[model samples]
Target: MPASTSIARARTDAADRLVAADEPLLGLQLRCGGDLPGVIAIPALREAVGKARMLGLKLARPIIAQDGGDSVTAWVEIDPRDDGCLIEFRHWRAKPLPAEDEGHVARRKLAAERQIAELHARLDARQNVLYAAAETAELAELAARMDAGRGRPWTDFVTIPGSAHQQPLHWRLLDGAPVAVAGSDRPWRATLVPVGLPGAEPAGFELYLGSDFPAPQQAEPSPVAEQIRARMIGREVAPVLRQPIARIIANAETIRSRLAGPLSEEYSGYAADIATAGQHLLALIDDLTDLEVVEADDFTTAPDRIDLAEVARQAAGILGVKSRERGIRIDAPKEGEALPAVAEFRRVLQVLLNLVGNALGYAPEGSQIWIRLEQDGPMARVIVADQGPGLDPAQHDKVFEKFERLGRSGDGGSGLGLYISRRLARAMGGNLTVESAPGQGARFILTVPAADPAGH
Candidate 1:
């Protein structure tokens, strides 16, 4: 067998093998310009192909007719074999003859050619719509799933290989990952491959927001956002405590009634302890819920240009009793021209109460917590400095960490207070920072942009 014949035979056999497997290949290259095979065929397509070949020849390059035929309609595909060449058979059909006449054949050939070309144009158009529709559905599913993931685990970028085809990964600020449902009528390959985020590239592919894998979160939220989320967790927790809180209140009230007249001393002690613990729990709930709601921006703020002195006075008033109970002194700066600062008055007071109250907890009995107002470049500032021992230099930065305690959890604390205060201050366009040294007490500085920041 000649080498050429051997190759042809191998191709013809390979086609037969694939066809045997029930996959009838289609010639669909005329669609979407992507060279897709086996989608649609035109009438007289084989005749038109022969004519197209003839048209490309020059005088010296007259097209040779394949052996024993005036024109070749289909070519055999020679596929590789382990021990020998395999031939694949392919067939194409053409209708209408030119009555075996040269002119008639030419005319038929031309007509067939025109028909094939038109069919190709239409097929290309159809292919575009097929892929486009698939992509549209994918994008829609992606958006819906993203919105639904508002509070679920791990969202953001999806890094799938080959996520984009011939095009650079498209979206600049994609909000959610593209989730896919298997077995859906959607194009998986050559349309969109899942990819990674910017800078996280895989060789031979780019990052896409849609993928078949899950991402592991690399970092935690920012401190401010962390604080917000921590407080907001109260909303998640309130349900669990609602019944318990109600039960406690009810039980306490029943015990206090004592209509049986003079309860036992041991019973009275138990009641008092229960009431104290319950009241403490209630206060914590209120604090957490308020912080959460404020941070969520669901509640309203009443901003006013009021005297800082008055805000301090109110904060001191509320905190003073608590301070006195702890034997701590709170010193408020004397009214100096009633220096006014713009803020959510109530929130400012809340911050003051939290901070001052917190300081008193650590201050030695009879130590002072001082509040003073001063000015720095482009801002008016309030300083809450305590005479109590301050944080260690190693731990100063950690002081604002949620649930971080100086000593123990039972030391009258939840580590969320400073975290919430700092976040709240910043959310209002101000900031709170600290200056401290171990055993030397700490000074917290809260600064805000003044009405005329420079006092100009």
Candidate 2:
């Protein structure tokens, strides 16, 4: 190879600290904010060195790093030794970073903020809290306080940095301000997005509370605690995995939507595929968490009197847009058509959602879905009927089995929905069953004890 592409040598100590390097490599390291005899600052290089050391292997690969306004690419060979690793930079190239689009930057920033936010709120024009939600127990107290203080400016609940003039600063002023919440030790950032036409007086705002750091983990656990942690999927594992997966989806969406700048159709499609897969993973995680709950020996539901018709309408309404996108229409029970039942309201709603959602997924374009209510003896029932490829009698039972997909692929389903839905129904003193013949569409019926009119 020519001198321009000649190898530049570097070595690290047993501690994995960069101990020595030749000219261009040394200069690049310093430019990347690292010092001689210091830890590798380039993330790609550090990872390669660590892998080589851990496996006691020799490897060659190309790595990219950013230095100021330029992107640096290099081909390096790593050889592990007793002390550390020897790194040979065989190829070195640098190119100026591409110009950034303002709109792209704004969209990326917004997506990132939404992904990291643990708390969210809807506020009126004057910044008064209308609704609030939190994902973790750490913010449960704050969310409760915000809910209780509805109609009051959200600023009353948290302290903003570098602002002492007064409470409830203008929306523009607090759009990206840092804040300190009562229960969280980590500093938080607030994002306020106005809800109105551009350049017009705002109607309301969407508030997101995000932190730069992950939630602090508890001190190291013993063997028993480790076992407990393993079992606490919903409480522990789900929350930890959600943020990163969400961020991955957000970034992929930004790229797929071209909000991050122009890209070839093939690359954009790849991004779309990535976003879809990420969404499937997220759904699977949620399903697994619910599976853990419904399968628990002590699992129970809070039964109450609820209107099956009302719940059916709600499920239809929630999935209205999705159905429309697929050219499917839902014929939900009309208002005032009530079939009162004794069951857990949310659990029943969940079952209906799964049924309706499944119908939407399988139903042919331009097909119709029907959500009807009926009184069967002492039981009240809601049936979700869809015009789709129906299931055989044998398959009907198999469909509700755990993780059963019936040979379908690429549909992004976890195959746990019906299983969990049935478990939820039984836990709520109800039963979920399906009826269909191949090529004749399908109907899913959910039945619960009829509520006593006198008691209701």
Candidate 3:
């Protein structure tokens, strides 16, 4: 290729470290819009390049490059082959078609049209497994097992009303009509769309599979709208509901304890049950509201330098009464023992309280629950080990899933505690994990980013 005709190129490793660049690529100064370097050096483009390299995929985009007074429209392609990204670029001035190089202009026009069609295909692809025509009707194992069935006949896998072979398959897609596809194990709907060079015969058809689940009758709310609704409910409804609920518990407690006046034994027992039920209701309400808050897109935690040991101690103390009632002892960290971690204090305390409470619930009477703190490199760890009937190996991960209680009955828990605790830990730059085997009891580990002593 001629020097000017050749595409400007560069190479970068998986880490996004610049390994090499051609003379033309480096010589051509690019910018985002102003003085800064544009297409070649922009963070978003580099990130895309890095992703393509890591995922072993091909990525392409059309970008604008300024060449003095001229606005150059450039097509960039990053192909990951072997280990690094092969970045290539082709550009044309953004002006009327050049008469002298009509052939070159035509090719550029075709590429631009292809890009437009590809963009539409991608939008459809978001909800479907996109596939292109090959010599055989094979399916590529992509997007997980969702798109698996390679090297098979199109007619065997898909059922178009009057089509057979790949050519007619492209026709079905080119017709822009819905076509039913045979699922590997069942029947499902799919869409085939023609894709190839513009103004030429399509080389293959783009296949899109219908989702197994039926579409909602009503459109689902957007994340932002969901967040807004969650915030509104959390702000306006929780406090309003909590006030009466709190008073009911308080009044029930007074009646049960007979603090105000003497009460009959039967009445006192009824009052105690009411108080217990009210407390359970209050906890459920709090959990439901917290679930909404955590699932919201805008959920965030306020982070600061907090001692993990102190948080664990405070959480154990808060749940101590219940532990004592159950005859379960909480073994917390000794005084002045600190494990500095970077996290929000209240959130950490809430997570620890949940873990300790869970241990207290499952552990046998007279058994001990240990809350130990330690540090590993950049992470601070709080391990809560219980002497309860241990979890099955399979149940370890499942327990962390939302609303998963592993068939435990009458626990008064909404099954959101572990889920919410894990989310809170992650929001504060940490994670919560469990280690257990049947008959061995369970150990819950909470790890957070350790804080620098100097920063504290």
Identify the leading candidate in terms of TM-score. 2
Tens digit per residue, CA lDDT, model 1, 293-332:
6567554444546456656655665455467667887888
Model 3 lDDT, full chain set: 0.60
Tens digits of per-residue lDDT, candidate 3, 1-456, equal 122445777776656655666644454433223122223454344666877877778998865433333334557799987756788877633433212244433333332222212111211112232223211011211222232333343334445555554533334443434345332232334444443323645333444443233222223444433433345345446544544655566566665554544333445567768766766776887787778878888889867777777677656655655676688888888767988888876578778889998898889999999999888899999999999888887888899999888888775788999999999989888899999988788999999999998884
The 10 consecutive residues of candidate 2 with the worst lDDT sum are 221-230
Query: What's model 1's TM-score?
Result: 0.44
Best prediction by lDDT: 2
The C-alpha TM-scores of every prediction are 0.44, 0.60, 0.49
The local distance difference test score of model 1 is 0.46
TM-score of predicted model 2? 0.60
Clashing residue pairs in candidate 3 (N, C-alpha, C atoms within 3 angstroms): 30-38, 31-37, 31-38, 32-38, 137-152, 138-151, 139-150, 173-192
Q: Residue 117 deviation, candidate 1, in Å? A: 83
lDDT by residue for model 2 (316-386), tens: 76576578768999999876788888987668877998999999988999999999888888988899999
Q: How accurate locally is residue 40 in candidate 2, as Cα lDDT from 0 to 100? A: 87
